[model samples]
Target: MQITRAQRSAVAERITQLERSFYGRGPSNVKVSVSQDVPVSLVVLSIDSLTAADSVLSARGHREAVIRHHEALHDVTRADFINAVEDVVGSQVHAYLAQVHPDTGHAVRVFIFADSGDSRELDSLDDRDD
Candidate 1:
């Protein structure tokens, strides 16, 4: 499925809210870039980089809950959805780094890069790479 920028913005905003609620403050010194690779049917949210504090936050149990919420919002499921959700949450910590530094130009990307019946393209790049 193709998630629009507006949708992504909404997700980002929610993520920010969640981060604020979970932590007294959001991530600092990092950027979160989210992109959906349609050919792979996957959502890729990259962090500009990481800091010591960011690393610490990622090591908490609540972090797993956050990822579950993220995947649940998108209705994603796997053979072991619970484990998958936890993994997503762990991965998402990096994205929150961007929310903490919005002016840094790193935003998270979400997309369905591949589907059960869709073709997969591994090398087609997006504007973020430029």
Candidate 2:
């Protein structure tokens, strides 16, 4: 289930592009980590806390909203595997927002798990063990 170096590089490049589009630049505190066992790449956004953003998504009754968002993007960018990774990262932002700002109702946190042979999975904030 390990992702190839080329795949990871492609995903990273797409993520960099996505960050520029969304935040006007990569997050100052954003961190990217890759796992070979799960064939997953994690884009962690450092926030002060989760209550501020977490509350929004929770209040909206959209536990898996982040995951769905990423899946949509994944489907849209059929040829670009990196797009899928960006989707997952984008989804995580929302999940993290919800987790950090529970009262704000703006969830943000995107976790992308890529399975063998180009398969990708997105998990929402609620889905996270933490």
Candidate 3:
């Protein structure tokens, strides 16, 4: 299943807005894509140029601290993130995986949608026009 440009833009904007509202800084770049790497299709959201404060911590040899902080923040806001995505995709998320690299100021959020037994090869969604 190919994702529409509007859907991608909406998802990216929602994530950026959430980051800015909660973290006081939004990612400089956001890319949303659908993947078919698993039994169920997945939504992959990649964030780039996150807050510079994280880089500062990494430079000061506090990378672990930054990672921990980000983990805690993700834990606290997982529901909101999932909800934002669900609202856009109209599907319940079965799992959400998030990771942040403090040194690079990049993050990835992988969402696995609940399988309805109609999985489609969506890895090419990013390559096609909706």
Best by TM-score: 3
Q: What's each prediction's clash count?
A: 19, 38, 0
Residues 1-130 of candidate 1 have per-residue lDDT tens digits of 3445554455444445444444444333322244444332224343432234444444553444444443443332221222232244332111111122222323333333334443322212223247
lDDT string for model 3 (1-130, tens) is 3446787788888989899887888888888877755534445454554567777888999999888988998877887888888788777667778888877777888777766753322323325545
Q: What TM-score, computed on C-alpha atoms, does each candidate reach?
A: 0.31, 0.34, 0.79
Q: Tell me how candidate 3 scores on lDDT.
A: 0.74
RMSD of 3: 9.1
Off by over 4 Å in 1: 28-130
Runs of candidate 2 exceeding 4 Å displacement: 27-31, 38-83, 86-130
Better of 1 and 3 by TM-score: 3
* Ranked by TM-score, top first: 3, 2, 1
Alpha carbon lDDT at 65, candidate 1: 44
Q: Higher TM-score: candidate 2 or 3?
A: 3
Error of 3 at 59 (Å): 0.7
